[model samples]
Target: KFCNETSDEVDRREHPNKHFICSFADCKATFSKLWKLEAHYSRHTGLKPFACGDCEKSFCTRYQLTRHHLSHSGEKPYLCSVSGCSDAFSTPGSLRNHAAHVHHQKENSYVCNHQGCGKEFRKKKQLKFHICEHTNELPFECDFEGCNDKFASSKALKRHWKMHKGYPCDEEYCNFKGKTWSEYQKHKKTAHRVTLPCDQCKKMFHNAWFLQKHKQSVHSGERRMFKCIREGCEKSYTTNFNLQNHILVFHEGKHDFACPFAGCGKAFAMEESLKRHFVVHKPQKTKLQVNLCDGCSMCFLIHYILEMLL
Candidate 1:
């Protein structure tokens, strides 16, 4: 019968999964129906109608347009499940590529063979940097005399050579040097002499250590060793250095070192030095007090004189 013969022909053409094959020569595309095969063959004949709204880009299939939209929106929907990285990609293929390149360090990855260096990298660019050490290649060198240091980069060598030049100190009556201008300023404020005044109080100190000690002893009032002679006042200091700072900042009392010359508002370190300096002027203070008792009057005109007199 004709019906039986048609059934036999259908059975012969059907695959194990009940899917039909494309009749086009040299094509092995599978389709569930004959119309599906005809629709797929139209792709080989250059039949494209789909277009994108953003860029007018055309594709033959809706799936292709869906993939292209990810590029336009910068939407990386696909992600790699690697340990250290959470990189997202636009397509599954790209996600797989990132995992192999970055996460897994695939078989094709370059590894440094230098002894004592067991570093492995996924990119050839990183490997090239490591190879520089094995070859002893100094790409950056200083041209200065008596300087033979080489660096990996030219910027590092340039910075290293600046150490030969003296840097300026930013303090009054202080002559200091450093490798850089910023470092010089820091040292001048912290180590040699503090030029920057405190914002809270208009006080000057030779260094930050002295300034901190002054603040803790005088301003903070936490410890008080140099107590006021007046009753009911508790004060202390950690050291004599801090005690001296407290006297200078709080008491505002002048010691024996006072100005010698008439109309000169400057003070000297000692009274005898001030007297010797006043000799250069036209007139000087004539109240020359002498010691009658050597044991009782131990004080002298200057600290050095007092040391010798004792």
Candidate 2:
């Protein structure tokens, strides 16, 4: 018997593999068991019943609190078994990530096959997400009504759902909001004007991760070229994002962005093209009433008005 439906017991009997849905607002997450649903609901409620005795940190789950205790105790139970390399981590997940990046460089690395883009990822799932950037393929579609949002990964889609129901900043007179708990923490850091500067170019970024990404993309000698696949089109772009825009405009004819001004409903595939089109609707500046001085060949607005006044 389910709380949300009168005939849920009958429905469950017919569909034995039916999942329990999370009751959190705008969250479409489903779990196999009722206990899993209850555990997931804590994320939206921001409830942390498990508190650490050593510090003021709290976690929604007991397992998470147990993991945090390892950091304070300086205990590294998870160790790398690779020959001649000794590294340990508090969590098994950390150990796995390190093993993938460090130990499995040649055999287990997932390399991208796209021309000019040879980015390697630790996991095949990460490689799949990176391929979407090159192909402009968005497979994860949001089920929210009136929203046609799509993402390359399920994680991105989950983060986007939080924007509809995630908690806002508790600071007074501030309307800052985030789509995830990590994003909220990032906002707090940025609100205080905390910045990370690049060592090579000295460009300031909002966070360390962004700064690292900037360094890898700009400073690193890695360049990618995406070309149009359409017949008779010899166009190539520096990025896949730009190549996607070219395809939408020239081949697919996906003119989604429309001019907001009334009576001139011209649409464009790219937002930049629509922005450039806005200049066509701009009001012409009024020309200044000026008279050319016969003596010095100088133009003066006051000279024309002063002659009429005289």
Candidate 3:
């Protein structure tokens, strides 16, 4: 009675030898062949039939699939394991190529012996190209009679020959002597006098550097040098560099270091610089408001005799 019950259970679970059920829940999808079942499962799961074991990427094509697996296995079966070369590959064909082209260093490998040229190639076709430099053998000649320069390749010759014909030059002071009209136009616009006019005044310089310097010196009214006597503050500098150094050394602080000065909520590179800057916040009697230009003004906490130069 126990054997009959076991047989009935097996019959209920098993398919008719050909039919296969989908693994997904509630969906009673069946296939006659195992391959059909796999294909059907792929549609539901978006699974790739072929996979590369090396990089762990999957592909549909067998060739890509095979290549992908090689990356993971480090199985460059093809290799050029010659002396002086530690290169490894996943395939035999690639290895054989490395040995023949790079490592083997064949006897018949012709090279260009030109003074400045150092090109070595295995094929004679490449060697022929190298020989052209020494012989000055211009197979391609420019059509322009005055511009009789020859080139190794017909394409280069064509480009050079185009230079002989007149082209449009757009530069303010540049002469139109380019091989093509478009090149002349580009040179005129880019290399010539295309510039940004300053919004402030009539004074103009070639670039923005002169303009920035003019703003800093002419517009910045007072040069307030706040020098601190803290142990870290060494040579006084123009900008924040000296101040940052002071904080780092005396205060044991970093560039992003916390301010060790009690009740100060600022982080500084140097402690001395921070202390010197904090002095400005304290109540002081002698304060001077120096006006540089009509548009610029700065406040200083020190006073000196203003000498009228004009």
Candidate 4:
């Protein structure tokens, strides 16, 4: 049982499996065992117990720590026993994955069948995930109420969950559990004694990346800016990516990638969107079931609709 704001026994042992639930306000993740619950809870507490001796890197799981150690050791236990060349890998998956990119060009049939986008893969799973980029289908979604956030990968969704379920500050007096990764990193530096202590304010940072960003954004006077030097525009950006985006979206209004349908100037910011829009232009061979949004009467693919509705 996990203790929380409500001080509840957040576990139930059923016939099939034991369910250990997280007691966080928005987090409703349930695990089969107490240890799994503890591990999951650490994600919200920013507690990375597993540390690498060679570097300042730390991980929540020992498996991740083991994987990190492999980078320093340069040990690839798994090797491809197939044909002409000898190739080694740290994991079994890597050996198989690299074969598609490097050697074993004949056997693997896992190739992208998308028109003009013929990329080869070692496994069907890789190809399937890659297909989502063209499809623009985000499978992972936040389960939090009132949040309709979606992600292409489960890992991305898990990372994004930091906003919904933040790691609590180690400092007893501090009640700051940040709403984002950057916020939490900064909060850990400023509030907790996890990172190197700041000389001026006596704050701590877990990593150097956060410390540098904090200095640049908060402490340092020499701020990096990508300023839009327009006639009347006073808009400035921190990164060049944002500056380019501002120029393209508002300044230039360049519709480089637009819908192929005649008289439709529906512009897209990304090329991936242009690829997905091609599906709309193509005549459907099989009748794809779609649902219409009640609010806007916009049609959506059935699977996508089901994913959203569920």
Candidate 5:
């Protein structure tokens, strides 16, 4: 049977009592339990009985309703037990998947066969996303109003949606923000490792694009070709893009970008400025040096250890 044809024909033939088939037309989804079959049937019948109290959203299953409740609570009950890693998720499935894909490594079965690029992935979806980079294929397009942006993957599209919705960096103490999802990712990279350095001035940048832009404006003495045409405005920029940004920020006075955090209605003219302002709202981490080693004078930087001990 095809992948989409979810009928367990072989299993049904061997043990008919063990398989529960869907009575819905053309959808022969086989389930082991009665409750599972009922839940699956809800999708066919368009019945969503489990409605969320906080929102108008409804789910076909109780498990989905329980998972959706975490969003309102902002609670991450499932935590990774892996040492030196601090990752949390709202659902047990997400936590399990994270542990399998991140903490544990397996032989990558799916390999990108693109020329000069043989990137391997544990999942076929990952390999498909990687292949898009080589092919320059952006199948996932942003459906946000007035936006024509496209992404290679659903992950990229989701992140791009966060940019439109004014989501800030969740990293503690990091105020870096970007106008685009790729820029936000590039900024996040600097938190873990040293960023790329300019060859001339040795000034570090998050990526090559910033490094090249620095070289053009600072080292190459690229003239401010784009001057503000607005009366009484003497502002100039190396690119027309920057000039337009200045106009939008200063003359237009558009501060539609609001803080994404609940109960915080703070707005900013630029996303970068809003990101910088967001750092103050993050829960401050209490850093402490703990002597983990009894044998030697070795100390380790631990966060929230004092709070936990108290």
Candidate 6:
């Protein structure tokens, strides 16, 4: 006899003993438990009884409040295992999805079936998107007045809208621009708020940060180790300046820095390295190894830069 026009026909079930339902206007959501009904009704009243311990934000559901706390703690539970890829995620499914798409290592790739096109993609979502490209369909467009900027995806359109809201630095002779609100705030804080004078170069900077970069890159005793970007190459260097020189001279077939010794046709990446080899054929200097904390190398690097400033 349950033959109502709008009721769920086949998959509907009635709760006999527990009969809790939302009393909110125009909301027909029903729940078997009182707590479930309370949670559903809270959305209509804009009532957020669950408050986060670390932040002022509140949520209607306890689960949402729990999830919001993770952001304040800076916890990324999922991590990528591929070499040279440090991308992290908040969930395991996201980590797996990124690995499959970015690394091209996923099994059973989804292939497109559009006539004579046999290109394969890692995900079903990607295959659907590739099909749309052949159809010449750009569904996402800017909402700005009289603008006709169309994009293939929603994310592209979102980043496009930020073009209208870029914050530019107004300091005399400084022509830096920030693309996002967070970036604008940081630029203002670091570039104009606090004046930090470099101890080595004696150059005045807005924030205390540029001082450490000036010291490490320009005057620090510790040298960085740069590795070859060519796949399967096992070569490394004391500095990127020398490493880039190596790529250009040896790999790219350039002979800019030749050995000055007569009858010695050997070439090198940097002129200084060539001079050192001309003196005596010695092994390259070892890189300065430091024990860094796992999963937070950047945090340590920023701390090191700040220490150098002092």
RMSD of 1: 36.4
Q: Kindly report which residue stretches of model 1 are placed more than 4 angstroms away from their true locations once superposed.
A: 1-13, 16-29, 32-39, 105-310
Q: What stretches of model 3 exceed 4 Å from their correct place?
A: 1-110, 113-128, 134-137, 144-149, 154-159, 165-167, 171-197, 208-310
lDDT at residue 299 of model 6 (Cα atoms): 22
Better of 2 and 4 by TM-score: 2
The candidate scoring highest on TM-score is: 2
Expressed as tens digits, the lDDT of each residue in 6-67 for candidate 1 is 54356456544546665666555676665566557554443445566554244656777789
Off by over 4 Å in 2: 1-46, 52-57, 71-75, 85-87, 93-107, 129-310
Q: What is the C-alpha RMSD of each candidate to the true structure, in Å?
A: 36.4, 26.8, 27.7, 19.9, 26.8, 19.1
lDDT values, one for every candidate: 0.58, 0.69, 0.54, 0.65, 0.66, 0.64
Model 6 Cα lDDT, one tens digit per residue, 168-267: 7767787888888678767867777766677666667553334545565457766455688888777776544445666777788766677766777887
Error of 3 at 243 (Å): 8.4
Badly placed stretches (over 4 Å) of model 4 are: 1-20, 23-26, 32-39, 104-310
Candidate 5 segments exceeding 4 Å error: 1-11, 14-18, 25-27, 32-36, 53-56, 80-87, 92-119, 123-310
Query: Better model by TM-score, 3 or 4?
Result: 4
Return model 4's CA RMSD, one decimal: 19.9
Regarding lDDT, does 2 or 6 come out ahead?
Answer: 2
Per-structure clash totals for the candidates: 6, 0, 18, 3, 0, 1
- Ranked by TM-score from best down, the candidates are 2, 4, 6, 5, 1, 3
lDDT of 3 by residue, 1-310 (tens): 4465553345445545645667786445666765667666654444465644322234544655666566534366654546666777776666666777876544467778878877888777777866887898868876665666777776576567566655645335657576666666566556774354445555554434344444444455744343555765455533334443654566664655455557877766633345455544553732443322322222222332111110
TM-score of each: 0.27, 0.34, 0.26, 0.33, 0.29, 0.31
C-alpha lDDT (0 to 100) for residue 285 of candidate 3? 34
| Per-residue lDDT of candidate 4, residues 247-306 (tens digit) | 777878865777878977788754434655666666485356555545322344555533
- Local lDDT at 185 for model 2: 73
* Candidate 6 overall lDDT versus native: 0.64
